[model samples]
Target chain A: MSVNILLFKITLLFYSVATVLYLVDVVRRKEKAGKTGKAARWILVGGFALHCATLLARYLEAGYTPVANLHESLSFFAWTLVGIFLLFDIRYRMTVLGAFSCPLAVILMLIGSTAPTAMKELNPALDSWWFPVHVTLAFLGNAVFTVAFVAGVMYLLQERMLKSKKFSALYYRLPSLDVLDSINYKCLSFGFPLMTMGIISGAVWANSAWGGYWRWDPKETWALITWFLYAALLHGRLTVGWRGRRAAIFAIIGFLCLLFTFLGVNLLLSDLHSFKAMEGP
Target chain B: MMNIIVVGLSHKTAPVEIRERVAFAPTDMGRPLHEMRALPAVAEGIIVSTCNRVELYAGTHAPEACVGQLKAFLAAYHGIPAEQLEEHLYDYQGEEAIRHVFRVSSSLDSMVIGEPQILGQIKTAYGYAAEHKTVGSVLNRFLHKAFSVAKRVRTETDIASNAVSVSFAAVELARKIFGSLDGKKVMLIGAGEMCELAARHFLNNGAASVMVTNRTLERAVKLAEEFQGQAVPFEEFPQRLHQVDIVLTSTGAPNFILGQEKMEEVIRQRKNKPMFLIDIAVPRDIDPKVNKIDNIYLYDVDDLQGVVQANLKERQKEAKKAEVIIDQEIGQFSRWLENRDVVPTIVALRKKFEEIRQGELRKTFSNLKDLGPKERQAIEALTAAIVNKMLHPPTSVLKQNQETASGSDYVDAVRTLFDLEIAQEEDDSELS
Candidate 1:
């Protein structure tokens, strides 16, 4: 009903339309160049711009970072996901990647829209420069993992089809195991540092505000768990040469842990990071 | 009409032994061209000789006699019995001949339909004929049209874009896995011909290097020298497998040469870099379970065959589109051929009338020597106009019928009635 919500809906529209265009290209392309892929990418760029405006508008109006509640967090998460996907798309030119990622972005935006979009008052203890820095880094890491998760699923699908000789349209549409594995490796190498920095920044902020760095909060513990899962996967890949199906399966598990840490911990547990739970519901 | 005739034995009609015997050497096509030109019915001739087909495209006056004579000449020139070659040779005349050449040039008639080599082979055949002064106006025009039609089919359809052979299909799969074949290493496990062929395909697709390993070290060295690669001793190939990205095995062994346990160790040694293994042997060299190993993909000959078959089906769909283009182009070329026949008759008819007119004018001019230069120019213009007017009806009729089914009949009547065939004969003789 409000202007920022209006902007959010328009952003959602752009992403949904982009999703459809990407899917159409995915279904139609047989290793041939098509206009739909390029069009979808441009439209996603428009959506990303509008999503940024929506976040900025909320920031200016509410006088704090926009990602303080469930609705804002999901919207910001989808926004960052699209930003990372576009970066990878520019590098890879994998139309199927857009076809997979844009739909996920659209679905997240839709679910976020279902939650209340009221501009809630920020908790006084949480209103600090560390809030934006910590959230942005964490969101960026999760966004990179999101793309890696997509690539991992594609790897498993392609490997199964090639091994069982039961090929589908997806088998032809997906990239090779080598390409998918490399993408996963790139994401982990890059995402790991951002996530580590996010956790450390959160610790610094927590120590300054709450008189402790490592509080045994549910969100903190879950974030640490997610970090360890990805850490083990990374260590295995580097030292033991773990790759392909085994690596893809672990990346998927690591991504699931990340999703829970982002959403499940905040919604289900009474923690200092639970913004919605602070409103007594 | 100009009778385009094709007399040939292709892979469809003849065995390799018979075809190879009848094939003409491309390096020395001069003698054959001279011999074919001397044939009673063949006006112009071009011979296309490839490993798959040996065909003679000839412009002829008598299609029936030309077909038999070309067949006989093929057998006699090759020192084979006429009866033996007769059963293998096939002939086409008029529209059928044009369609046959078009299909051959488009690669639709190839043993592997849609393969690109046939078009280049046809161009080389045309080049030889052009150099020898064998193919004249009709064949030169027709072959050019054939080339353009082939180009049309290539651009309008996707027939030649997909891999429909085993070796090509393997390369296609490798491309999908590696995204690009640059700097990748290929290994051939044995000295089988198919294995060598697959290795060549990989090299052509930009595999950085090749390693050859055979049961016999001498043979390995010989094969490796030909490919300009290293010959790994058979005993050391297992240890060297880690260096290769693609492995092609076609040994005549009874048991598996590459077991799952060995492949696992090899993948580890390669530092989880993916390996594409192709077992070209009937008794599979690599164990099937190796396919289940991470970063290791194994395909036997049957799997490659499956890919080839699927790609063949896709090409067939594209080939149908090519056929449509061929059919549309045939109409334009057929009209051109018909117009060619009518054009000679019309030219000879006009030339006969001009000769008569000039003879009469010269006599008139001598008698009227006092006539001015202006009057002489006026008289010449008058004669041209009258001749054109007198010739208009029959000329229009010939032009109209040139595109019809009865076009040849009208041309023959005009040529015979005016004795234009004699004039055309002289014209052709003077040109030759």
Candidate 2:
């Protein structure tokens, strides 16, 4: 196997270990939990560094950005998600977040491993400066939304536990609703603008290459739908003071739409953005 | 083994009259601490005296004698008869004593569970003992471990995270709403003792300013002067309502003083800033409907009591978790104490055998003028093996039984049967 493939395998191993450690932290609930969480964070950092190295190596071999195919895109997506999660973990000091986020990242990386790893040349139509900017912004926005989705799920669980007045491990482990709501708001404020910029850049790139900006392609249509859903969420929150459980539910819905746009549109439907060369034998 | 022993009378075992009589004055603690250390069996001593409890923690080789002397000392020092003091006093030895100190430092033994003052009180008492040069290595290590256990319990549980009093509950609710009380203004409408107490709670939590108003201007001025706040006219208080973040109304007015419509305008004037209104009067000063307004949260006396009750129940639950932590730490400390007990005995036994073997070897060597170096070495090895063979069974028994309650009995029997002179100074040196 190539060095990049070996590095990718190592990254997968680190993420798997981190996921187990985070789960152990959830179950142990004391000094052991704190120690395991710190260990998991360090391992995740190591994995992230190796993931970056693998991407760079692949970039060197491909003579372009490595995210032109399904495998590379999925790997990039997981890397950005873990990066966003680390930032949240540092700021909030909520180690329990790893219990949810690490597993999600591991699943994404596992799926990436299944896809073909062979580097393919970019389509001539896709050769533009705006491509990398659009892809990075889109993935970064998805990563932020991923954090919001996790926080939303935790909020719902905490709210249920609180309303029922049954104090369990979940109740003690999850952060308060006020904290989760603020995090949800922050993620939305950050992710919405990046998503808008990603869509705008994609539109501009399409106009330059395909001579049309508003094609009703399945991917573009779904991206627009996801953007509108988040737009409504932000509008309701800022104007009408929509928050708490209602806001949490909307965040979950918005993430589902985002997931369908990113994954379902690329795989289940034919589109101009599809990388046909990714399905290598 | 130097066992830890605690003798004390707390609020649970003694009334305030008896507790106050037994409590040592802070200035006079040095005399009793020194006297305690001078006792026959007490290797280390610390006296903790607070309004709620008076406790003595000591390290002693003979726990029974130490406890007896401490009881006599308490009665003699306080000028009370020993018979009168015995009914109110309680004592714990060994692992129980360790657990008691751990629970006390964690605030689990407080009159109001999770109250924070007992830890500071215990620390001050320990400080007095440490300064007087009365406490030694055992007590120093024990107290430090208790402190760490207390810290661990605090971080690992939510024992102290709730309010047990009405005023404290109001402050806790305000914190939940506003995050912090810093720079927030409080307005008191009319004068009631409970309302003033809650206002003081907010002030203590860092509210910036206070405004007092009553039906009579002079009364308002009097109350304002007492609180170091400005006096506002009762009629004009509603106009200035937007300036304050918290409103505490306790007027005896039979009707509601603040209504929903007025509060809506007040909230709007404050630009939707959050407001906490606490109505503490029996007839209820603020209208309950006002609570429905945006950014306005109102709680009456019953609601505050409800919060206090809920918080108290939560503290009780967290206290159970703290107990589990204390149990684990007690197991660890007891094991350490057991090892400390056994090591010196083992050393003394070995030293006694080696001394006899050396004396006999020297006598035989003096008589054998033809002794070769090889022959001398062979004799030394043979004597050492015989000593080892003879000592192994008792040594193993002592090591194996160190953790049991009968371990000390076995140690004493061995010492008496062998006529071992385990010099106290020599044992201390061996331990060091």
Candidate 3:
């Protein structure tokens, strides 16, 4: 295996270790378990460094930004998600958030590693300056929404535990509903714009490459649909005072649409921007 | 042997009249604690004087005399007749006493099993005892151990993790849904007493404000004044439903006061903010279908009762687990007590060796011709010297361990090797 693949595998190992430690912290809430949370954080940081190294190595070898295939897209998405989560961990000091997010990173990395990773030549027709910008913006937005999805799920769990009046260890471990709803809002505020910019930039790039900005490709159509879903969720939340459980569930629904746009579209549906395109945007 | 003796009356063992008369004021604990320590054979004392129980924990070398004096002193100090209080009083000594304290501190012995307040109450009692300087090393170590045992039961088992009352269940449910009740508004729809009490529970839990609406405007104003909240006209409450996060309705309405259609309009008007509706009225003020709406939670009194019942069942299970933990702790604590009891353990070991030496000598004297009294004395001296020499090293080590409170393993090993419990039983039988 090449250095990039080796680096990616090590990153997965680090994330798996972090995932286990985070799960321990989630379940066990003793003073001793606090040290476990701390250790998980440092391990996650190590994994993130290795992940960065893997991406840098991939970019060095592939002669372009490395997010051009399903495997690379998933890996990059996981990388950005971990990065965003670490930043939030710093601000929130929420180890339970890590419990929710670390397992997700490990799962994403595992799925990304299963795809065949042999390097291929960049396509001549699709190579452009806009490719890296569009993919970067879009993937970053998706990563932010991924966190919102995690927060949304946590909110629902907390809501049900409170609503049903049946509390578990997780209920005590999770942050308050206000904190989770605000996190959802914060993610939406950042992610929606990044997503909008990515779509617009994709249109601009489409105009440059295909001589039209308005082709109804499957990826484009689903991205638009996903955008509308998030748009409505955000609009309802801000203008209509949609809060707490409603916002949490809406954020979760929006994430499913976003996930279909990113994953289901490229694999199941034939589109202008499939892995078959060779130089993915 | 050092004994922990408890003399007390609890909600289970005594009527409230007896308990209230005997209950020691926490502020004036120093006087009673001082008097308890001054009692003969009572080495140290703690007075745990909660509403449900008033227990006197005494560290004594003479459990019988100390327990008797404590019982008598309780009646004298409270000016109640000894005969009147005697039937209500119960006592436990040694292992049973420590186990009782552990169970009480962990809330396994509570009136409401697994209620959390008892632990804090015990801690406060312990603090008062410490402040009064009445608790010596044994009671001090024992009380701290009880506290840690309570903490162990708290973390290891979910004993005190749920609400057992309807009002508390409502507060807990609201907390889960809204996270913190801070800045959340509550609306009281009617003047029913249960509804008002539930509203107070919400207010106390940090719900930002309360809005009262009754069919009678004057009564609404009166109830609103008590809550320090604005009185909403009954007709206007539905229009203002958007203003509050929690709505508690318990009016004597014959039919449903709130149905799905009205709630849908209110939900829309509120812009999909989550709302909690607690219907405490017997006739059911809110339609059950309102629960089907998005972001709206509806619970009647039955649901609240169900939550309380389930929580109580869970607590019963947790209480069983707590008893197991306390049993384990008592075993460890017994070893700790044995280790700290250096002088007594030393005396017991010496007695065991002496008894063996005398038994062998008796057998020797029976088999042989009478060695003169001189020879008999010399043989006795030899055995005595040997026993002292053998015990000196381990005995001195055990003595040195007195300050550090270590050597429980050594103490336990010695007890097991010597079969000390058999010696204890014989000693107890002789004393009786």
DockQ each candidate and list the results: 0.41, 0.18, 0.32
Score each candidate by Cα lDDT. 0.87, 0.85, 0.86
Give the TM-score (vs. native) of candidate 3: 0.80
Between candidates 1 and 3, the one scoring higher on DockQ is 1
* Poorest 10 consecutive residues by lDDT, candidate 1 chain A: A272-281
- Residues B1-432, candidate 3: write the lDDT tens digits: 567999999999899988899998776888898998899778788999999999999987677888899999999999999999999998999899999999999888998888889989988998998998888767887888888888889878878877888888889878756778998999999877778888899889898899999999999999999999999999999888988999999898899999999999988887777789999988999999898787788998989998889778878987888899889989877876764466667777888898999999899888877698899889889988988898888888876654432344455467777777664454334223
- Tens-digit lDDT track of model 1 for B311-393: 78878888898988889878777865664587777987898999999999999999999999999999999999999999999
Best to worst by lDDT, what's the order?
1, 3, 2
lDDT of 2 by residue, A1-281 (tens): 98888998999999999999988888652322478888989999899999999888888877777787788888999999999999998898777888889899999999999998887667777678888888999999999999999989987886664433334555556765667888899999999999999999989988987899979998889999989989998998887667766778988999999999988888999788777833333
- Tell me which residue pairs clash in candidate 1: none
TM-score of each: 0.78, 0.75, 0.80
Please, what are the lDDT tens digits per residue for candidate 3 over residues A1-281? 88999999999999999999999888862223487899999999999999999999999999988888878988999999999999888888888899999898898899999987877777766678888899999988998999999999999998787666556767768877778988999999999999999999888888887889978998899899989989998888778887787788888888898888988988899778888886533
lDDT leader: 1
Output the lDDT of residue B50, model 2. Answer: 92
The TM-score of predicted model 2 comes to 0.75
Model 2 lDDT per residue over B229-347, tens place? 99999889989999999999898999998888999888777756668888999899888888766457788888888777777887888899999999998887776566457777787
